[model samples]
Target: MLSGAALSRFRKNLMGWFAEYQRDLPWRRTRDPYRVWLSEIMLQQTRVAAAIPYYERFLERFPGVEALARAPQEEVLRLWAGLGYYSRARNLAEAAQEIVAKHNGVFPSEPADALALPGIGAYTAAAILSIVYQKKLAVLDGNVARVIARLYAVRGDLRANGTWQKLQATAGHLLAGRSPGDWNQAMMELGATLCTPRSPQCLLCPVSEFCEARKQGLTDLIPVKRSKRSTVELTLASLVLLDPRGQTLLLAPPAPARKSAAANDVHTLVSRMWHFPSVAVLQGQAAEALRKFAEESLFRGRGFRLEFFALKKVRHAVTFRAITIFPFRARVAKLPRVSASKAFPLADLSTVAVSNLTRKVARAALALN
Candidate 1:
């Protein structure tokens, strides 16, 4: 805990650093709540460089809360396709609708009110209130938390409830400037750029003198992270069926579940998007398992005969799961009468929304032709 005078000095030094070194991000350009909300949501679990283009494009399509509320779910999902986390896009659209109905298309200024909206957590609420409303509130995100932990040498389980409270209280204590938004961003920026998780740049840090971790030679160990779960490796086998006319088969979402447990699991992963019918299977029996899956779920007594040949393997990962997708190219003589599969020209994949894994499957299948 810094004394009042020491805290004041810290704030002045941090603010000075921010003035000289803060990167120009689009979200920093305006105090508009909508743009701030959009950028914040897009930045979740995504890097700044990756989120910028998507942020610009999303705003261009849905300029305001009313526009986002009126846009179809598919259209929003299409724009957010390659962004990975589909749940964030869904919540963004849902929150827009809630704002239009509940707040009359205006963003809430109060942190409490802002938190009531879907997907708006404490950090987001604080950021919005401080940045947009200029409230003297502190922001405690991952970066800020790490910075705070190191500055105070706050060890032990940070995920513990009491530990987090201490961190938040300390953050509030240090937020001394008149412009809380700039101060909060400055702390986070320092963490992101200088106090990185691995090999922090303490020499260039503006407030290194105050960092207990640096003084104690424990910068790398101050902010303890929660242990990750064991990685699960899976072998996914997918059938790339093409009709005699040569359009590749793709199943639309809400596709009925298959009997195979492996296929059902993969189907759940992509419950709301289009993809080739795929199943996780034993490496030794991948071809036979996919053939059985295609016959039962994809063909469905439509007299469509699947003649498939196994393609090269495509590797991909989703968080803790590492997957190697084995694609099999098949020729179909007839179309399914009861299946949800639709044939699309391989050249027109960009026109529709799909997962990154599905794109890899498409690429692997196309290479065969």
Candidate 2:
């Protein structure tokens, strides 16, 4: 509830500090709405360091909204392969199509219009509008929320909608009219670098004088979150089918069991992309089941002399399961007709969206070939 000159002074001090010490990130170098939108989407559940390379690769492949809209869905998914949350990639493609059709291929300038785009919510819309367009809007992402909660010593479950609304209101009131972009960036920077979740460096904070948590010795406890749901485990068995010609096999994920009237559908992992034929295996049987399944499902039906090659393991965390993927490679006597696709080269391993585990197997198989 800062007001009058106090809010102005707070913003001035924060922005001044930001000018001196903001991190040099790739996204900060451009004001292009397309680039901002891409970075924001890629960073939804990913860290900055990981998102940077993906962002660069995506931009290089599809440089603009029109290019993204015209690109094949498979290509888009391939660019977004390792980055999980496949729905984000789908939404990104849909949004690009919308921008091209409805907005003449130009990104919407207003925050509300940006929010209307697929996969964009209030925080993303606000960020794009403020940072790219320099609009006088407050952006309250997780980082900003934590920073604001700690600064004002707001004590409640931040996950609660009421608590979030109150914090957003406070943030809106604090934004300086002249420098909304800098104010937003400063708040996010402070949260990310200084007001970290554990052992916050409050002593080095720019506006320590205005932080209630700093004054009251509650820097570590003000921004509280409810405990998350327990993670559920799942086991997957992935197959790498190789022919005598050294070509591998891939399958597209099946369509939804049912489609809504509006055509909105829920998609599974690796949806709309090229992936190795895989099955969910029972825990502890991943190794054996994969070998047997590959022999029966692939080789016996096609009459190929299958030789079990190397087995490579990959550990990745999905929403719940700490997935331990065991990739088993087998070389067959001949290539199956189902293994051919115009979109991907079964002979070339680099063109498909294989899981990280499968990628490891493919690389090993290539080296051995």
Candidate 3:
């Protein structure tokens, strides 16, 4: 708990640091609720540096809420190609349309209305209202959570009820009587820059004097995390089917059985893009896995004397599982008589939407060809 005098001094020092040191991000220049909402969505599960180019390009293409609302979801996903997390792109567009329908293309000023939108959650609603509308609501993103946790020496599982409640109280208490835009940005900026999760620069921190963790030498241990999910190993085998014209065969995903967080990850696997048959396989059965996948994917049914090439492995991480992917390439001498929908020429890959994971897989396999 911060005393009245201590909180005032802390906020003063933090905002001073932010005023001089905050990065001039493109989104920071505008108070447009649309842009703020877009940035917040993109920044979720994505790094700031990577999100910048996407943000700028998306804004150029979509321009505003009305523009985004008018654009097709395919174009939006194409513009969002290689960014992964395709649901965010889809949901962002849905939310824009909702805003247009509900608020005449303007973002809602009320937190409840914003939260009612398709992808806008509590944190995002708070951020949009606070940063753009200057509503005095505390933003409790991962960055702000870390800053608050360390400043007050919060410990235990951050997800635990008591710890989470304490952090919320600390954030609200610290946010009292401050400009929501400046204060929220200051807390986040401090966390992103100085008060980082690992090896925080205590001496350089603007509010180091007020940080309980720094004074107690517990900076590294202050924001203790709950036990991590155990890392599981998964081996995935994909059969790459190619035509005589050097076009790669791609297919749309089958409908998933149900919707869950894990289902969302699978959505990222082949959302609106061309992809080969991908499936998890048991260990040490790479050959059998490829054969089964090839059979199921019409690679064998095409009757084109396919020759297989064992390309290099592509590895990717998702939550607890580290997937080691083995891609096998097969070529058909003659093209199939029937035309396909989503297949594209390998050379013209740039013209089509491709997931970042697919790009990574292609980089490893295409080099072999």
Candidate 4:
């Protein structure tokens, strides 16, 4: 609980240091709520370096809220294909439409109003409103949380809700009222560059004199790490059926079956996107499992002999699920007309909205040829 002269000195040191050393991010160049909101959303689980290109390209394609709202969902997903966490792109467009319809294209200034948007949460609402509208709010993201924990020598599970709330209070208390935007950015910059999680450069920190963890020689020990969820390993088998005209077959995930279907029937990796016909398979039986799946579902009524070649295996992950994909390709005179399946030009797959896992599958199958 820093206060009085000590708090004033801490604020001065942090702001002065920030003025001399903050990174020149493109988002910092403007106070536009839309751009700031977009950057905040994109930065949510992505690294800064990986997010910059996507941010620039997304802004170029849909320059403003109205443009994003007007664009088709598929097109937005296509442009955001490689960036992953596709729900963010979807919600961004939905929230834009919401702004246009409800607020007449102006970003909501009120904290509650901002939080009412599709993907905006407490931290997001606070960050966007503070940085763009100069609202007196503090951001307590992972980096900022780490800095706060180390500053006060906070110990225990920092991920715990009670611990987190205390850190948020500390952050709000330390916020520089007059320069809320710069103050928030300065705090984030300090955590990201100097107060890093591992091997923090305490000696170079602008506020080292005020850090309680440094004073107690606990800089490296404070801020206990959060436990990770256990990974679930899975095996997936996919079929890439291509016709002589260079079109590849894709299928919508099958509807959940009742208990009547074979016990071996597999589940699709992703839903709501077109993907190669695939199924989860038992270890060491990928080929046999896919053959059975294709014969029963893909060629049930149609009379076509199945001849397939195995392609390279692809490894992918979604959240805690670690997957190893066994891809098989078959050349046919023409693709079968299966229900819930469609054919797209293989060369133009980029135009379609598909998961990164699907993209990896396509790349693996293509690379071998």
Candidate 5:
């Protein structure tokens, strides 16, 4: 904890550094709560450089809370297709509708009302309220938490409930200066650019003098890492069927449960989105499992024989799962009349809302053709 004089000097140094060095982000140009809210949601689990383009494109489409509230959920998901974390887009649209119905489309100024919205938790509520409403609340996101952990030399599982509450308290105490918004961003910026988890640039840090972890030469060890989940390797066999018209068959959400013995192997890699017919396979059973799956679910009563050729494999990782996808392509004489699937032109896939995993399978299949 910083003393009165020390805290004052620390705030002055941090704010000065921020004023001179803060990157010009698109969200910083406006105080609109909707825009700030979009940036906050997009930046969660996404890099700044990656989120900027999505943020601009989303704003261009929706424009405001009313527009987003009025838009279909599918359209919202379509705009957020490549951003990943589809739930964020869903919640953004839902929250917008809530604001329209319950709050007349104006973002809530009260912290409680903001927190009541979907996907708006403590950190998000604090961030938006402080930045847009000047509510004087402290934002304790991952970046801010890491920065606080180093500043106070806090060591332990930072995710532990007790430790997290203490850190939140400390963050609130350190909230100084007239601009809580700028102050919060400065702390997060310092953590992102200088106080990184690996090889932190202590030499360039403006608040290094106040960082107890740096003073003790334990900056690297402070903010102890959480235990990592063991990676589970999974293999999925996907079939991409194309008609003579060059239209590809894509399955809709909630794919039928695999009746194969490998049913338990199925994972939630792809959510409720358009995707190729895919099934998890045990080692050395890719061909057999997919054949049975196609026969049972995709090709049943469709009057088309399933003759498919293997395409290049695509490897992807989602959180703890390392997935290797076996893509197979087949040309059909005509489109199948399956209720669970739809045919889309292979040339233009951007019109549909799909996951990155689906796109990977499409790209791998396309690369060979």
Candidate 6:
């Protein structure tokens, strides 16, 4: 419970430190609500360095809400290829379309309006309203959560609803009225750079003097995390079905189950990009199973010579599945029309939204070709 001159001192110290030490990210260069909103959405569940290229590419393509609204979903997904969490891309496009229709192509300045946008939650809404619109809203993200938990030496599981309420109240109390945007960014910057999860640089922290966890010599242990669940390993045989001309097949992922809407839709992963026909390997020999699945699913009973040219193995980590992908490539002498349409020339692999595992397979296949 920070109060009086102590709270003021804390805010001053944090903001001053942020002004000097904050990283000069591209997203921080603009005060445009649309740009800020896009960056915030992209950065969710994504690293800053990784998000930069995607952000730049997306902005270059869409430029504004109207452009984003009009752009095709496939193009948006292609731009968001390497960045996981495909639903963000989908929802962002939907939200953009809605903004264009409802708000005259302008992002709403109010937090509640921003919150109404698809995939825009409390943190995102606060961030956009504060930073872009300069609204007096407090933004609480993972970084702020860690910062608050450590500062107050909060001992409860952070996932608990009560803990979140407490954290929100604490964050709201600490926000400075004049520069709420700077204050919010400052807190996030501090947590990202100095108050890190594993080995926090307490000596360099701006508000070290006020941090209860540091004073109590519990900086490492203050923000307790919920226990992690075990991951399920899945073996996937990814067929890199390439025609003689070098095109690949791709399928749209099926809609997610009602209960697991947040989880990655495997159907979308395959459907969104051009890749060799693939199948899940439940049991039996890998090569035989892959060939049989391709014949039935991809070839569709068409008679085309199956040439097993290259086999490459790649591993990818999804939220719940540790997937091992085995990529197999074969070139047919009489390239079927079906293969020709589905296949992409081995040279233009970057144009598609293939998964990292499939990308690895493509690289290997290209080298072999």
lDDT, candidate 2, 168-201, per-residue tens: 9888988877767777888888888988888988
Model 5 per-residue lDDT at 141: 80
* Cα lDDT, model 4, residue 300: 77
The TM-score that candidate 3 achieves is 0.91
Give the alpha carbon lDDT tens digit for every residue of 245-338 in model 3: 7877666543434353453243444554556666667778876867765665564565535567878888877656677778887776644433
Per-candidate Cα lDDT values, in order, are 0.82, 0.74, 0.77, 0.85, 0.86, 0.78
lDDT of 5 by residue, 158-220 (tens): 989798899898888999748898889898898888889988999999998888999999988
lDDT tens digits, residue span 256-349, model 1: 2444234237755553578888877887889889878877876655564556788889988776778888888887675454466677776567
> Pairs clashing in candidate 1?
none
Of the two candidates 3 and 6, the one with more favorable TM-score, higher being better, is 6
CA-only RMSD, every prediction:
2.8, 3.8, 2.5, 3.3, 2.8, 2.6
User: Model 4, 278-347: lDDT tens per residue?
Assistant: 8888889988989888888888747657787898888887677788889998888888888988898766
Top candidate on TM-score is 5
Q: On a 0 to 100 scale, what is the lDDT of residue 143 in model 4?
A: 90
Summing lDDT over every window of 10 consecutive residues in candidate 6, give the lowest-scoring window.
255-264
**Residue 12 accuracy (lDDT) in model 6:** 88
Sorted on TM-score, highest at the top, how do the candidates line up? 5, 4, 1, 6, 3, 2
* Model 5 TM-score (2 dp): 0.95
TM-score of each: 0.92, 0.87, 0.91, 0.93, 0.95, 0.92
lDDT measured at residue 206 in model 6 versus the true structure, 0 to 100: 84
Q: Residue 301 of model 1: what lDDT?
A: 54
211-316 in candidate 6: lDDT tens per residue?
Answer: 8899899988878767888887766676665655666655443334433332333443343454556666763466788878767766678884586754767777
Worst 10 residues of 1 by lDDT: 255-264
